[model samples]
Target: MVFVVFIVAAIITFAAATKLSTYADALSRLSGLGSLLIGTFLLAVATALPEVTTTVTAVFLDNPDMAVGNILGSNHFNLLILAVFDIIYRKRKMLAHIYKQQRYTALFGVFMTLVIALAIFMRLDIPILTIGIDALIIVALYLLSLWIIQRTPVPEQEKNHSSQEEEYSLKHALMGFIIMAIIIFISGTALTLSGDQIALITGLGSSFVGSFLIAGSTSLPEVVTVLTAMRLNNENLAAASIYGSNLFNMLLLVVCDLIYRGPILQSISLSHAVTAIFLLINSSLVCYAMFARKNRRFYTWPSLVMILFYILTMVWLYYSS
Candidate 1:
């Protein structure tokens, strides 16, 4: 029964995500926001609604481990999106042609993941009005990342699409984005419940369920958006969407912390540090590959290592936790 519900919810989420990506792209072009900005802020946030909704639900249920795991897990799962893209891309390496903003965005992701890991390790008991210092820092740093990325100019070639006459009205696009978001919220909430049930029935633990199962399920929109962007031959948007979605996933933890009474970071199983460490490693590798322009034959080496690391971390989490 749980499996059936999970599958149904996943299907709905995917269908909603397909439409959401279309409207998000239209909104970006029509609103004069450009793909990078819109991908980072608008599209990214919309796609991340699943993670946001799922994490909020977990926290409200007093499952901080699952809440934090979903964020960290989602961050790493997003990196794996690059690996999938690499496998399908027949052209040269995917990351080699990405814009400079994407490179910087990956760097910022690594830095923020590191900050989160440190907080978990330190397990600070102190909280100002029930919010940990780390939670505040994560939120502040996320805003700074957005500001920097927005200010960093995208290549003129990339702006060509935005200059053309819009295909959809601002009202239509906004409405589409909203309607799809609501669908995602409902499906995502269902996914969270099913994930918890699966974890309980199988003894996989919330950390494992959140990091691998829930995170991957919530990230379905990202998969669709990336594939769509790549098919359109819009590599920049594809790359930007991944990094941007990751940024929003990190912020979901802040929402969890605010809702989870007490220091959310310190309260969850420190075993989560395992997932966080893997996240830092994966994000750093992505930054290196992007900056170095390493385009290996078949697929990028960094992406291969990324998949391997994620699998190993999952194994470690399963047994150790």
Candidate 2:
């Protein structure tokens, strides 16, 4: 029964997510908002909203580790999606086509991840008001990343999308996108509950469920959105969606911290820091892909290494937990 609910909720959420990329593209065209900004901020907020809901719920349930695990685990999974992009467009690397702003976004991910890892070890999450001081720092950095991304210049081709013949008027696109986003949020909540129940019945530990199963459940929308964007040949939107979602998930930790009574980071098992390490490693791999600009005939070492490390990290986390 739990599995059944998981499948139904996932299908519903993913179906809406598929259209999410389309509506987002239409919104970009009709409104002339660059795909970079739309994907990074707008589409990003849409896809990552589920994490906000689920993480806070986890904290309220006295599962702060699960909440942290979901954020860091989703961060790793989002980067894994980036590696998939590399394989999808192998002849010409995925990084080759995207705007330079992505490097900044990727760097922001790395910096934030480092903060998370260090916070766990240092226990710097001193309670300031309701939230921790560390959480406050993360919130501030996320805002700065947004401001910088907003100011970055988009390519003329992306800027000129408004000139193309459009299917959705700005009004219709806005309505459709809002409606789909609401569906995603509702179904995603269902998915999270069902997934948690399944994990319980199967006796998968909370950390495992949070890092692997629950994180995957929450990321289903991102998967569908990125795949649809690929089919549309919208590389910029596709890449930005993953990077943007990654960034949003990091910021989400601050929210989770706020909801918990104590410092959320200090309360969770240090096992979660294992997940954070994988995030830092994988995010650095992404930056390397962007900065190195090396392309092979079929695949690159960084992409391959990312997948390998991800699998290894999951196994390590399982045993450690």
Candidate 3:
């Protein structure tokens, strides 16, 4: 019965998220916003609504480890999106170019992952008014990262949206984005709740379930969004949406910390450090891939390593959990 509910909720979430991607692309065309900004702020947050809903709900249910696992797991899962794209489009000239902002965004992701890992390892958390200072730093760093990315100038060649479709009103696009976001939020809640119940029934442990299962469930929208952006030749949109959501997932720690009634980072299993370490490694590899001249060859070695590493990390975590 729980499996049935998971399937239904996943379908609804995926369907809404697919529509959400289209609306986000429409906004990119109609708003005159830079593609990265639109992808990072709008589409990234839209796709991240599941993490927001799932993580917060986990904390509300007094499952801090589950909440934290969802964020860390989602960040790593988001990085894996880049690997999947690289493999699928390999040997094609598509997505052969790299953007400076993407490199910066990925670098920021690496740094943020490092911070979380170190915080988890050291556990020297000081709480101010029940909120950990580490949480504050994570949120502050995320905001700074956003500011830097926003100021980074867009390449003139990538600025124009060249679709020949009939004009889409910004009003209609905004409405669709909002409606889809709401549906995704509600359905995501169901997805996570079912995932939690499944974790209980299957005895997989919330660490495994939240990080692997629920995290993957919530990230389904990103798969659709990235595919649509690549289909449109908007590589920046795809890349930004992936790395941007990773950064947002890091910020989710603070949300969990605020809701969990304690220093959320210190309360979770140290096993999450496994996730943090792996996340740092994956993000760093992505950063290297963005700058490596080999990236121009259209056959990416780093992506291959990343794909394998993601699988290895998940296997390692499942057993450890």
Candidate 4:
């Protein structure tokens, strides 16, 4: 029964994700919000709906580790997706072309990593007030990002693309967006329940299951969007979606803490700590790659380095925890 539920949940999740992506793309066009902004804030949050819902549910049931593990595990899996994207889009080197906007996106990622790391290492008690404060900060950052983007002039080539694309009808897109959101919510709830059941049956602990299996399951939307975008030669959107998702995941930690209604920092398990550290390292490397002068274009070496680093991190996490 548990396995059956898992399969059902997976199917629902995949279908909803595809629909959500379509809605998000359409909405971005209608809103006149550049793909970078939409990808980073709007679409990223929509795609992370599963993680948000699952973690909140886990915390409500007093399974804090599951909540922490889901986010950390999701982060690790997200990096793996990057490697996959590189392999699938071998000729284009998607990361290189998107590095221009990625600079800010990567910085936001660094900020998020730092916040999570501090919460983990310092063992800070995140009170409701702190969560509220973090939420406000996220809102402010999002608004600031928009203002910056609005002020920054688009290049002639980018402007041409923007102008040439067919304008999306707001009413139609909104209807699709609403329907997709409902599906996402329902599927996310079912997936969370299935994940809980699997953890109980396997006796592997909910933290492990949530961090690895459940986290990977929820990140499928991101993987699909990136791979499909790459195939379509939408390199910019692909990169935007990947990095955007990371930023969204980071911010969701604050939301999770708020929903958990306690000091989430103190509730995190040791395994979660390991995952957080790995995320920090991964984000750092990405930041370095973006800023590095020579080899600005993502070469084979950095990609290989990232893959090896990811493997080692996972191995260490498995052994240490």
Clashing pairs in 4: none
Predicted model with the maximum lDDT? 1
Q: lDDT tens string, model 1, 77-144?
A: 89998776875683657788777777767887888898899998988666776787877887888889
* Model 1 spans with C-alpha error above 4 angstroms: 163-167, 294-299
Tell how far residue 91 is off in model 1, in angstroms: 2.0
Q: What's the best-to-worst order under lDDT?
A: 1, 3, 2, 4
* Whole-model Cα lDDT of every candidate shown, in order: 0.83, 0.81, 0.82, 0.69
Tens-digit lDDT track of model 2 for 177-208: 99999988888677667766766787777788
Candidate 1: which pairs clash?
A: none
Model 2: lDDT of residue 117: 92
Runs of candidate 3 exceeding 4 Å displacement: 92-96, 162-167, 293-298
Candidate 4 — worst ten consecutive residues by lDDT sum?
Answer: 153-162
Error (Å) of candidate 2 at residue 312 is 1.0
Give the C-alpha miss distance for residue 220 in model 3, angstroms.
Answer: 0.3
Ranking by TM-score: 2, 3, 1, 4
Candidate 3, after superposition: displacement of residue 201 in Å?
Answer: 0.3
TM-score of the candidate numbered 4? 0.87
